[model samples]
Target: MIVTRGSRLPLYLAVPVVVLLAALPYLVAPPVTRTLVGLFALVVLASMWNLLAGYGGMISVGQQGFIGIGAYTVLLTDIAGVSPFVGIPFAALVAGLLALPTTALVFRLNGGYFAIGTWVVAEVFRLVTVEFAAVGGGSGASLTGLSALGPTLRGAVTYWCALAAVVLAVGVVFAIMRSRLGLALTAIRDDPTAADSLGVRVTAAKRLVFVVAAAGCGVAGAIIVLDSLRVQPDSIYSVQWSAFMIFMVVIGGIGSIEGPILGAIVFFALQQVLEPYGVWYLVVLGLVAIAAALFARRGLWGLATGGRDVRFLPTGYRVAGSQGGVSGGGSP
Candidate 1:
């Protein structure tokens, strides 16, 4: 691989830039500002999927399990008299805590089994939520009070938090990957047996990634509930949640931070443009994903950057010839 002496910007500078970019809709157009926040929420979910699936070698189809946990955490906490904002962090912790046993169950499987196991977990959670009638149970629950505050302010707050979640997850993933743990993750991804032989603790690493992803995904779930101001166990725990995450990460240039963001942009843009087709919209999306997975390899950005990942977020440090061994060989 040809080395690129890439000059990375300081995270201090990048974080503010990303945060400002997230707030763009709030500043320029008060109307639909919340939509921008929603986009960031999707990015947060996508980032978690990317980290878990892309780097950690675990493709989960049931990440919504934690997402649902987060939503209910907020809803349940609000019922208990805590502020919803305060409940958000608490919700994330709740989700992470819930992840412990689920890991034991799901970890028993590998590859496609692991993926399917995740979906089952999401489904089970959905069914459990349906039994609680006071919270609307099967009918779902609303994020009532916050919805009454109107759009602009809620949009601003959610946007900030969503951006922060994305920033936080991405930053943590970047840091861990740059540190010794990052090296371990890379080794595991490349060859689990060799990584294990090197004493990298494969299962432990995967479990850690899963838990962190669960926490971030939980926050995203809270944001989604906030966005719709409602939560139906069925809707929140739908397998489509996993489907969308897969779509965004796969087409966005899977296994990389930049991939999900680009995929989200393209996914949303396509949705806006082709949504009139109803079911056909999904057909087109599937076809695009199929094609990207089969031929493009690195995704749309790969094509745009000539296969070199030039990150605007400035998250990690790439030593000379450190990554991207195939084809173009980076910035040269």
Candidate 2:
């Protein structure tokens, strides 16, 4: 593998930007802080979905199942007198554990069957959760456990948790995509049969990617409920979560890390501006997504960069020019 030095411009620009964003709760109004929390969640969701479908070639529309699991995990722990803040990591763990058995069953199918099977799994999770009356089942329940904190403190804590979750989610994806596992994933994605023949543990790689994506989505779910202070099966487990993730990934650029982040930002921006238009906002979102799919299949980020080798988080090794240093290695 050739070693190369990636552009340092993004890192140089991102450091202070991240620090500013981290201190946003202290500097901004409550509504702005709340919106940033939601934005962070979208980034985590889009990035994880990209890793799963783009790199792993495992298209799963059932991620909302894990999202709901995370939300409910927070609820369950809170009911047991634990702080909801403490429940976030536990939510991720439970979601990951659930993925083990779930993957074992769903991995039996391939192609479109696999996609449909995942959706079926999500529905199963939703239906079962509705049967559990302890968590308000059909009607859903509000999280009263956070009542002890002042409003300002609650918002700040939620925002910080969201920030941390996004960081972890992105970090994990970058780490995986830049490692030997990433190379194997690339081989498997391009040709699974060939990859298997070449000694790549295709099943293990897929399973690992699937579990990580689930855990990331799970953390996003927990953050969502933590911010909203409520969780309902209908809303938390809605196919809409997966739909948004797909839209963001597809419109931003499926295979690139920066693409999802860009797509999420665009989606969030559009949501903020067009939300008051009611149903028209949905129409607009659909049109944008369709346009992106039809014209910019690599996504807006790809288009913006002229489909070059530009990457905010570089994943693979590239050979260097004799007259120049390594061309494109990403920052840690």
> Which is the leading candidate under TM-score?
2
Best by lDDT: 2
lDDT, candidate 1, equals 0.78
Point out the worst 10-residue segment of candidate 2 by lDDT.
1-10
- Model 2 lDDT at residue 127: 98
Superposed model 1: Cα runs more than 4 Å off: 1-16, 22-26, 309-332
Q: How close is candidate 2 to the true structure, as a TM-score?
A: 0.94
Q: What does the lDDT come to for candidate 2? A: 0.89
**What are the lDDT scores of the predictions, listed in order?**
0.78, 0.89
Query: What is the C-alpha lDDT profile of model 2 across 211-281, one tens digit per residue?
Result: 99999999999999998999999999999999999999999988888999999999999999999999999
Report lDDT (Cα) of residue 93, candidate 2. 99
